[model samples]
Target: MFEFAWPWAFALLPLPWLIALIAGKQKHHSTLMLRIHALAHMGMTNTKVTPSRKWPHWLLAIVWALVVASAANPVFRGEPITLSEPGRDIMLAVDLSGSMREQDMAYQGRFVDRLSVVKAVLSEFISQRRGDQLGLILFADTAFLQTPLTRDVDTVAQMLEESQIGLVGRATAIGDALGLSVKRFNEKSQSNKVVILLTDGQNTAGNLKPEEALILAKDAGVKVYTVGVGADGRNQGGLFSMLGSSGAMLDESLLKTIAEQTGGQYFRATDTQSLANIYKELDALEPQAEQEQTFRPVDALFYLPLSGALLMLFLAALWRQLKQQAVVGDA
Candidate 1:
């Protein structure tokens, strides 16, 4: 549909005529180079006013109308699009600690780093989130809001994809990640706040402790689904307390407790398939709202009339110049 954003601008259509009427009348006095009536005709040159051309005035009127039409901001609006309004506000905190560089997660039968696999699966998940405000937090020694909570899922996905291991530091700050996520959610008014924190290790480095962050999450009413990501054989020993080499890295107990306390769930993603499945489960849990929301795509058409007006003015000016040249040649 075609419409005007500023229809009132059409009232300016008569402005040119008003200005012409007000300024049109002027006193013209010819110089009297005579001593008296006897010498009045002695080499007296009278100034002659050229007759105004009708075409120029008519052309200008048309230009004024076009300019006014342009000022009215003509727009072409496309058909209305009904979409489900975003109800869920999901925050994704992916571990960017050095351990995330571990090639334990499998993709297409080949072993890839945990971060790569997570990016692949999570980007797909983010793309599928049609009507959800998504945020991203990349955490290592601390958590950074890579992308704010926004309906632009592509940006969130791109941030996740561009993340590098140890971009911040070399230690997993799970507590800091959780705390930041909760803090962000509390700043918003949305009731459906969710945080998906994926980590291959426990709270190794950060100011906030995992327990403290868990309490914060619960208090803030933020649902946190913790995913313990890594290959099973590589991580062994204790689920609660610290154990052998890199074995104690994946703290399943702490993750489970965090999820349960915050009325969320914990999943152990031993491989890529399980990681994707975990997200699928989350989809089933917090499905996108099915209610109706709509918007119309609009395109500005003011430029069309505006450019036409400019071109018309240029052509009129050229034509007037050519006509003047022809008259001079005839003279």
Candidate 2:
């Protein structure tokens, strides 16, 4: 549909006519008629004052009308769009403690760090989450929100990929991570609020205890799915493998408790495949509706009329200048 953004501008369409009417009245009142004998005595010919050409005045009126039309801001609106309500608000809390550097997880038959495997799998998971608000939280000695709950999954994925071990600190703050997730969920009024926490070790730092965080999560009605990521074998032999070495220390009891307390499930991911499978299960549990959304596309048309008006004015001015030059040359 085509319409004017400021239709009120059309009210000024009579402005030129009003100005002409007032100017005519002023001219009539200011008129000074002299007798023909007085003019002959002054050696003046009986010359009549010829009225100015009306074409220029008419052209000016047209230009003014065009200018007013442009000022009305004409636009072409496509169609109205309706958007469906979002499915879920999922917050991802990943462990960035020093232990996450352990390389027990396999990717493409090659050993990779725990964090790398998480990033690769999580990126795919994020891509699949259409119409869901996703958030990212990185935790080490403390927890902090990397990205707020948003529908921009690509941004959350980028932030996850950019995260490095020990970015916050070397110790795991599981309680703080859960607490922060719960706090964030409370801020939104979404019906389905979820938190997926991936960590490799027990909580060694933070103000709140894991149990206390679980209480808050329950109160907020936020579901928390916890994943304990590491290799199973006690004697795994990778150059960076900390599983058989001193780095393997997962608090499965606490993780399972948090998940169960919040009416969520606990998953153990020993390799990249398992982690991917865990996220797949999550997708099944919280399936997104196939419904669609719509919105109108608008294109501004003010420039069209505005440009036409400017061009007409320029041509009118050029014509007047040329006519004046011709008169002067003839004289």
Candidate 3:
């Protein structure tokens, strides 16, 4: 719909008319009389009087109307737009300790490190969270919030993929990762707050303990899904298998406790496929909302009327100039 933003401008419509009336009165009062005898001597009595050329009064009135309309600031309001409100605020915490450098996880028949496999699978997972705000946390000796909770999942995913082992330090800070996630969740009012914490080793560094972080999560009403990433079965052909040694030691019990205490579940990801499956399960658990909220959009249309007023003024000036030139030529 069209509407004036400043309807008060209409009150100035009679200003030009008032000015013209006052000027006419002043001209009439100042009229020079008295020179009948002088005019007869100068041949003014029989001289042909040339009528003064004037522009149509209605044309001036149209210009005034255009200027008034432009001052009113017209606008066109568009229809309301509906947007889907996100159903969940999810934070992804990945371990970047030295242990993540171990090449125990396999991706497409090739051996890859735990961090590499996590990035490959988690990137896809992050993309699938269409209606959920995602954040990233990287932990080693200390945990750091890589990205804040945001609707731009692509940026979060890119940060996740760019993460490298030992970026923070060589020791795993599982507790710190959870603590940071909980702290971020406390800032938002969303009811469905979730954290997906993936780690390969136990907590060897950090100020807060796992139990303390779990308590904080429970108090903040944040659900945490924990995953212990490592090798599943015995290595059949690797050098570690020849020496009868297993891969890195993962603290599964602590992870399970954290998840269970926060009303979430625990999953073990020994390979890329299992990690992908875990994220798929998470997607099923936290679904996007069906109903969406809406808002109206408005666009200003003042420029359209203002441009018309300017164009008309230009044409009027050109017409007046051409008429004056024609009169001069005839004279």
Local distance difference test values of all predictions, in order: 0.84, 0.85, 0.83
> TM-scores of all models?
0.67, 0.78, 0.81
Ranking by lDDT: 2, 1, 3
Q: Name the top lDDT candidate.
A: 2
lDDT of 1 by residue, 114-178 (tens): 78999999999999987889999999999989999999999998888889987999788999999
Superior candidate under lDDT, 2 versus 3 = 2
Against the true structure, candidate 3 has what lDDT?
A: 0.83
Cα lDDT, model 2, residue 224: 90
Instruction: Tell me the tens digit of each residue's lDDT in model 2 across 23-59.
Output: 9877764453434445565557656442333446677
The count of residue-pair clashes in candidate 1 stands at 0
Q: Model 3: clashing residue pairs?
A: none
Q: Which stretches of candidate 1 lie over 4 Å from their true place?
A: 4-73, 81-87, 96-107, 110-120, 130-133, 140-172, 187-191, 230-250, 290-293, 300-331
Candidate 1: give the clashing pairs: none
**What C-alpha RMSD separates each model from the true structure?**
5.9, 4.2, 4.3
**Candidate with better TM-score, 2 vs 3:** 3
Model 1: lowest-lDDT 10 consecutive positions: 26-35
**Poorly placed runs, candidate 2 (over 4 Å):** 6-57, 79-87, 150-152, 187-192, 234-249, 289-293
